[model samples]
Target: MPDLLETVIENRWMVQPNHANNLDTAHGGNVMKWMDEAGAMSAMHFTGETCVTAHMDEVNFKQPIPVGDIALVKSYVYRAGEHSVRVRTRVFRENPGKTETELTTESYMIFVAIDEDRNTTSVPELTVGSERGERLREEALSDAP
Candidate 1:
């Protein structure tokens, strides 16, 4: 079994002119693509198999990340079913040299493990190895609809 925390993934993207919209803020589509990729990574890491995104829950753009800011995407697997992994993904706006980050977008995504044949396959059970892992799982569960 893989610990839930072991599946956590964090990636950062600098919001540049190409990623910006007319308002000079990060485009919604770009943000969504980043989130989806991060969530898929988490799921694949946990399952030890190729994962394909099956569904995405309600996603809200809470704030706009302006150009020159960094889009920090974080994702972790919180739950797993027979062949599916549920991941919670969040995007934050971070400025260089700043210790604090602001929430920009959030969503829950589900991915199905896939075998070499591209057929859905079973996934191993997820475990919480430490207090932080337990807490993270709880927090995601509480946030669920």
Candidate 2:
């Protein structure tokens, strides 16, 4: 079994003109789409089954991403239950000159595993096999908002 931290999934989307709002920054809707996709991947990795978004705790846009910037979206399963998986996601702006990545957005999402019949299904217990995985789970629990 892989650790939850090792199960992290990431996707990158270039900020295009169509994805931007009137201000020329990446639109909130587009960001949400990226977050949803990345978070779903993480949930699927943890559950080994298809999942649907049960709830979005909160999406905080800390900084604006420009049209030319690349949005690096990363997600990992932080906690899991019988049918629900909690995922933590972060969006970063890719900048070559910066030594540190700039966090643009973050959110906590909950997904419910589903069977082929469209009914909720049980998932395996989350194994925090590594120290990093345990740390992330603790952080997720501590930071409710």
Candidate 3:
């Protein structure tokens, strides 16, 4: 079994001019790319197999992260089927000088485990190893619209 908490991942990236658009904010595509990478890591951690994205929910961009801000991406596996992992991923904007962060984007992503031959494989059964893990799973489930 794979512990859901153990598969949670958080990463930070500094937004630079290259990642911004004419409005001087992080491009939507770049933000999604970061989310995908983080989500894939969570899925791989839970499956212990090579995983590729199967689908992604429509992304809702609520805020813009300015070029000087830092993008904080967090991803975690909340549920799993026989061969697919469901991950909840969220991105936030963090100003370098402030501790608070604002939600910028959120979406759910599905990843399928695959072998070297690209055949789908079984994913480890998911288990909540701690109270926190269970709470996160509930949160993810309840937040779906």
Give per-residue CA lDDT, model 2, range 83-140, as digits (tens): 8988998999875445567899999999999999999999887888778778888887
Q: Which ranges in model 1 have alpha carbons more than 4 Å from their true place?
A: none
97, model 3: CA deviation in Å? 2.6
Question: Which pairs of residues collide in candidate 3?
Answer: none
| lDDT of the candidates, in the order given | 0.97, 0.88, 0.96
Kindly indicate the candidate among 1 and 3 with the higher TM-score.
1
Prediction 2 global C-alpha lDDT: 0.88
lDDT by residue (1-145, candidate 3, tens digit) is 8899989999999999999999999999999999999999999999999999999999999999999999999999999999999999999999998999999999999999999999999998899979999999999999965
Residue 29, model 3: lDDT of: 96
Give per-model CA RMSD: 0.5, 1.5, 0.7
Residue pairs clashing in model 2 are: none
The worst-scoring run of ten residues by lDDT in candidate 3 lies at 136-145
> Could you estimate the TM-score for every candidate?
0.99, 0.92, 0.98
Of the two candidates 1 and 3, the one with more favorable lDDT, higher being better, is 1
Evaluate residue 25 in candidate 2 and report its C-alpha lDDT on the 0 to 100 scale: 91
**Clashing residue pairs, backbone N/CA/C < 3 A, model 1:** none
Model 1, residue 99: distance off in Å is 1.1
